[model samples]
Target: MLQIPSWKRILILAVCLFGIVSAAPNLFYGRVEAHNDAIAAAEKAGFETEAQAAARAAWPDWLPSGLVNLGLDLRGGAHLLAEVQLADVYKARMDALWPELRKALADERATVGAVRRAPSDPGVLRVQIGEPAAMTRALEIAASLATPVVSLTGIGQNDLAISAEGDQIVVTLSEAEKLATDNRTMQQSLEIIRRRVDEVGTREPTIQRQGSDRILIQVPGIGSAEELKALIGTTAQLGFHPVIARGSATGTVPGIGQVIYPSVEEKGLNYTLDAVPVVTGEELTDARPDFDQNGRPAVSFRFNPAGARKFGDYTAANIGQLFAIVLDAEVISAPVIQSHIPGGSGIITGNFTVESSTNLAVLLRAGALPAKMTFLEERTIGPELGQDSIDAGSVAALVGMAAVVFFMIASYGLFGVFATVALGINMALIFGVLSAIGGTLTLPGIAGIVLTIGMAVDANVLVFERIREELRTARGPARAIELGYQKAMSAIVDANITTFITATILFLAGSGPVRGFAVTLTVGIITSVFTAIYVTRLMLVFWFERRRPKTITV
Candidate 1:
């Protein structure tokens, strides 16, 4: 009976069973023959020594995929917190507005201020206007920008500043406009990042906004944090155009409203009257990597119903010409048309390897980031450090457990010994839950578990004290044991609740690994309460029923 009742015993045992089971697949693969083939390949390629190759190839799917055995800090890795550069986003919208502004202010003089590509980088253009009256032309075209606008203040009265803000050429926006534009910009940025991450293939990456501008990302098994950094950092601008027809290309622009991707090396190349794109890449609903019938690598795309109809109509209109597929404004492939494609689904054929296909798939799925984020901090840990830390953490945990066991045995004699045994089970359950949930065990998480070792014993101590109090009044073993659990429950619940609240706060306020600590703490507390109160009580009841002693003693 001193061994917890079958139900509570089994309840605790199941978590242990699960942890062991989850680890088994990986262990089995370690010895499998297919893993041996993989090792042989690695060794032949000179990538690894025989033993190292064997160790690597033997890892099974259930095992962690990359180098993160000890987790983020120990094995140096990146932890970045970045805010979207809204100023750049605004400048992009404004640049787009520039043309409309030019067209609106076209006012015959083309008296546009000295307009040229921005010097900082070619992607943006900056315009310097002369006089407040001259700036009027820009303002006349301002309504065409089709986005929230801000007014300027710093203009040199006689000299109007088109680029200052507030008292400068670029001015402060009205409160209403600022709020509206910021909201839209933030959402757009989040969507782009999400889309880009999806394209890049983050199995279970965490991408969420903090406050107004910052984004938080957590990818569990990412090996090359740098690769992800680069992908999200790019701003891809894709376009397409029809090729000029042979007969219509004789010095005349056959593509009036239609933009043509001529065969020339640059945008000015002639010979492109093929026809127009049914839909731009912006209409893409989904993209993935696949292969053609011959197994040639390619990118598959699917458009929405509206995009499909438009694509079909465009194809029908230009059935015999060439259409250029441009990515980031460069021609990738020019597929000649044979017939119209009424269906929105199709593939982008290109020269690609397996790895490139995977990367491209990830990028397409994640979409694009609104703006690139720079890594503020980066860390990568070698396996040796990770292994050493794991060893140290294990030693610390074993020492703590032994100490807890010794204390329990001394405090309540035989009963204390039984509670200490239950504490072992409690620890097992905490790790079991963590393993099952794919939770990373951080240094702080280890600390939480160590604190939980004490917490797991708290209820037992309360029960033992209650039993002692009842026995002082000469109660029988059965009654003392029953009453102890009944009375101690309230205090146990109260203590655990208070700690749970603190864990919740830490999870919210802290970032990265600190929050991992909080998750472990909360889970440990919950598991502790169950093992302490229910499992320990179950053991006492079974012990008492069998012994039937008239007098109880600790």
Candidate 2:
């Protein structure tokens, strides 16, 4: 008999009802979005304003609030393709190594003679020894500083490649170390970019690596590419260096281990500082905008435990000396230490507006980008264009549904009505799953939904065709319907399983929009199978039990 048990029928109806309720929020997307944003802002600030309260009240708190996030193609914002300068990390590595190597050689000055740094390639450190015969001893000293590379593939390999060329000792990163550094640098860049974007509280921004040295950023709801660049482009490299001397821009050249940087506020004035910093922004634990004693906008920062100890000791030892506050390469201020600042907390005071101070705090709190990035391509999509895409996608989906519904009804008369109802439920289930999982919907995803609408009725067609075949025999209506479903089950499962496997492959192998299409297709397939195999069958069972007719049209 064509019958479903009482519990099975209830389960089917409950699932369809749950999907409709969960997807209802999308019908009033704008109001619900505002309500969500308001609640988020209030929670973050720990207090709600009048406007926030009003917005939160726009939607009921008891209803399902999850909404499917729209992608850049549907929401419209900034897109950027940036290339990371991996070579920059090489120079930084060399610079940091120079002080340690120079110290090691100086401890063995009698054997190596006098060691002086010589100019070399950007990523190479070269040292000139006064005695040519001591070259082998110099190489030994440099090699002692090499540590094992801290990567799985670079096991048993040292980080530094040290050799002798004439009277000069050459040191550069080893090949294995270079490979490890490139991967580490790219990973750090991606993490820092994600942090910077997330700090601004944007919804579902795509920050992902594209190739070996490139990143693709798509931030929806931002104003433009330039704004997005301004948010994440600044290196925000902050350091505290001991100032050696201050003079005009044309002053004498700095020593081997020192650098000269122009002051941020004072025109034509420069300060020479130690190359190594007492503490860098990487150790910073907190940073926020504040006002100075003179009511000028500034940034206040605190450091972690290790950095605090180093900073406290440095300030205690050099009480009256100038401490340079460097941002990027320029000295923000080189204030003389009035006392031993033991807490590792300090204020950065310079020429700054409130907005600039706040932005600096945000950058410092997010940490520095490991390497510089150069933007190769940028685009800013308008919201109007996104609305047009949504409108077109809506039209396509509606037309596809209408066509599918008409074909089913014209072919199978009243059974088609049950499949049409199941089709509507199928669409609802797709969006419901998307909302529940916080999935993003793109223009390509819309195409997937439209494609699913046409495919949703496929199982019904199979079953109805099978029933037509059985009706030609001498069997009664109930037995014919039961036989149709039983015979069609194998074909339905096989076809859907094959299509699902293809969707999974596309998802694993593709990127960006292709992945978006795959996500929707995958979700649609699952929902369509459920509605076709179960929901439509349950509806048919109810109709047959009520009518109980001996003769029925196929």
Tens-place lDDT per residue, model 2, 1-554, is 88788999899999999899989999999999999999999997689999999999999999999999999999999999999998889988888888888889899888888988898887899999888898888898888999999999999999999888999999999999999999999999999999999988898898899879999999998999999999989999999999988989585788877899999999999999998888999999999999999999999999999999999999999989999999999999999988988888989999999999989999999999988999999999999999999999999999999999999999999999999999999999999999999999999999999989988899889999999999999789999999999999999999889989999999999988998999999999999989998998898888888889989897
Candidate 1 ranges beyond 4 A from true positions: 1-71, 74-88, 95-220, 234-237, 241-280, 290-296, 306-323, 334-346, 354-358
Task: Point to the candidate with the largest lDDT.
Answer: 2
Clashes of each: 42, 0
Where does candidate 1 have its weakest 10-residue lDDT segment? 153-162
Best-matching candidate per TM-score: 2
- Per-model TM-score versus the true fold: 0.69, 0.96
Overall lDDT per candidate, in order of appearance: 0.62, 0.92
What lDDT is reached at residue 378 by model 2? 99
Candidates in order: C-alpha RMSD to true structure: 8.7, 1.8
Question: What are the per-residue Cα lDDT tens digits for candidate 1 across 1-554?
Answer: 13455775677557555544544443353254345445555654557666656565566645533211235544434344667776665554444444544455445345544432222332233444444455555544443344433324322221112343221124223344545556767777667766766543343455677887777665433565675567666654444466654332445643222343433233444444323343566577777778977798878888778888877887788788787766544455667778988798777776767676666656655554445555555443444665676667778878888888888888889899779867876776676566557566777777787888877888889989998987888776777777878889899899999999999999999876778789889988988887787767666666767776777668
Off by over 4 Å in 2: 250-255, 291-297
TM-score of 1: 0.69
